[model samples]
Target: MQKRAVSGVGLGLRSVHYDHVLSRRPAVPWFEVISENFMGPRGGSGGRPLEVLAKVRREYPVALHGVSLSIGSTDPLDFDYLKKLESLASVIEPWIVTDHLCWTGAHGKNLHDLLPLPYTEEAARHVAGRIEKVQDAIGRSIAIENVSSYLSYKHDEMAEWEFIARIVKTTGCGVLLDVNNIHVSAINHGFDGEEYLAGIPVAAVRQMHLAGYSEENGFLIDTHDHPVSDPVWKLYAAAVRRFGAVPTLIEWDEHIPSFARLQKEAAKAKEVQDGVCAAAV
Candidate 1:
């Protein structure tokens, strides 16, 4: 499939805002859709959701973000899932296809979580091999996103950033830098967020995710339920400075507000990006 360039600020295309987005045609430069939601029946085209997605695609660029690739799982890769994903990509023609770097489940059971992976060379190699297989199946490069974590592995051999960089280097996949996840992981693990950013290869970064997190019992949670916090906004500025106008998306999956509220958040991102670019001159 051909790649498209997604510029400016974008919004996650939630069902709640379908009417508003399709009718009003908001100022969003692009929209990202969850891949699994549009996978229709076997040997068939996507259903109503895909129809709506096509409408949105007509007005803005779209990117496919997935949650269940299970790239880090021990089980054999799911060719069925990959086939569906490829079919969706063939239709959407997204700028990029992306999923979390962490695994979802194994043993034929869907864990329904973006579980962390061991930051070891062996683990990196294993996941990189899986990523390559995924890219080959999809017929294009896919970006792997860093996920937030509340725990660390005892057998980890390197820092999270190092592991991610090594995977990108080995597999030639792009990085979807989620600034909120970096901040949440940094706060939970007591690491410097800027240092994490510094360790990553900036050129591999293809897109960015900006979302809000909640604090509970002195621990931060990657709950995409609220507005972008001030600290996340600041980190996003740093990301824009480093990545130079990468496509950024506002992800509010839980307690989703009205379309206008989400558009306001996208506007805020554009404002911050504009300020950062202007100051660089």
Candidate 2:
């Protein structure tokens, strides 16, 4: 299978590692940035954040990953947010743009967390229609990422993977399959991870994510603080096998580590990909 603009494994571009990335320009294949961070106050040149993003763009292909799209909210879409997002996309010209399939909040208030939705036919149609509008606004198809959930709604009608497959089928959008999230949710909700993998559409996956999690009371929390867990790494290998080496990213968000250590995590992902692809060949 042919990969997207970015191949191999990439790292999340956090502010802490700005100098190392700017000065050293490490061997990382690509970098993903939080879209809101560089959205830049409407009219300004985006000040320092935009400047740094410009510098990074010159060196590597950047993917704009967002946390605030709230694609599944019951409330109407936020035009202002879309305007800023569109402006950012214009400036960055990101290789890909993505946000969580879950909603953030409703009624004009922001909860600021990626909350899960009820997996129903109504939700499927609602979110798909919203995604089509979002695609029209952005002038491009954005990938929707599946989030790890600690709870489920009583009204859900299908599995999470089935819901995802429905969205992509309707909107023609891509999927950012987060392997670590599947590991976390499978443990929390007691579902078979392999079955979830088999349920998703293969060609819809445009990217994959691997991150660390914290376990408490036998429930896995999607905390990107620790290194990628052993089970998640195993799941990632399975994903590469099923998806044929799609562009994967190593995400470490909180309690950021040194650049060298971060690179080591990305390197480990690449090593796993190489092994999987080699064996398949």
Candidate 3:
């Protein structure tokens, strides 16, 4: 297994704060970037974004988080996309590479959304096989994150946590546990977030994601627009206790805030992490 290079808390690197981060060089341990944004024709090594990313990388570790891997789709694996992703990885050498467990498209059509998959034995085997192939293609293991869902399939034979656990056991891939996603999914589908946490194998989790969500018409949306909710912070505390200081990140994608605001939010995660570590001792 690859050693974890990132620790403590981190903030997602947004283009809005590129200048601030590059100029000031904040003390963030690492930054997670959307993989697709940097896969330019030149493999992103020569683009302006790549130049900025190179500067950030000189100061901090980076992780590649992707949204369009489509590992769960029935369509044939897109080797061309995988090749480009491999090239980007070669340049960046991210501490970790990851994508969502849900499928984003099907039948050569880009649906442009992280669609949920059926939680069944067959689905688990299929996704795990694809992940294995992806690892071989990239020449390294990758983490898979869970997506928040508003609906469930009637044919699901297992719980969401069970599905993820099975995938990890089968593929030997790490888990990027998204705390906000767990809370949103639990509330929307009527389950306990703590139960979900407990069901996951602690050793399989390599990283954790903390973000904010919004409520609309009684359903909680994974908006990542506001501050981390109090409830999600509590869940994060639980996760820290269970996982023992896994690399954590604060994700704020929409309504991008000032670099200072983002740093303040990251500071909160650091506070929680320090408190948890102290209590553990």
lDDT of 2: 0.92
Regions of candidate 3 where Cα sits further than 4 Å from its true position: 1-4, 41-46
Task: Please provide TM-scores, in order, for all candidate models, with all chains considered together.
Answer: 0.96, 0.97, 0.96
lDDT digits (tens) for residues 142-255 of candidate 3: 999999998999999999999999999999999999999999999999999999999999999999999999999889999999999999999999999999889999999999
Best model per lDDT: 2
Would you list the clashing residue pairs of candidate 2? none
lDDT of each: 0.91, 0.92, 0.91
| Per-residue lDDT of candidate 2, residues 24-72 (tens digit) | 9999888999998987655654678988998998888889999999999
The Cα error of candidate 2 at residue 207, in Å, is: 0.6
Greater-TM-score candidate between 1 and 2: 2
Q: What shift in Å separates residue 245 of candidate 1 from its native position after superposition?
A: 1.4
lDDT of 1 by residue, 1-281 (tens): 33466698889999989998888887888889989889865666578989999888878889999998989999999898899999888888898899998889988898989999989989999999999999999999999999999999899999999999999899999999999999999999999888898888989999999999999998999999999999889888988888888889999999999988988999999999999999998
Which stretches in model 1 have alpha-carbon errors above 4 Å?
A: 1-4, 40-45
Model 2, residue 61: distance off in Å is 0.3
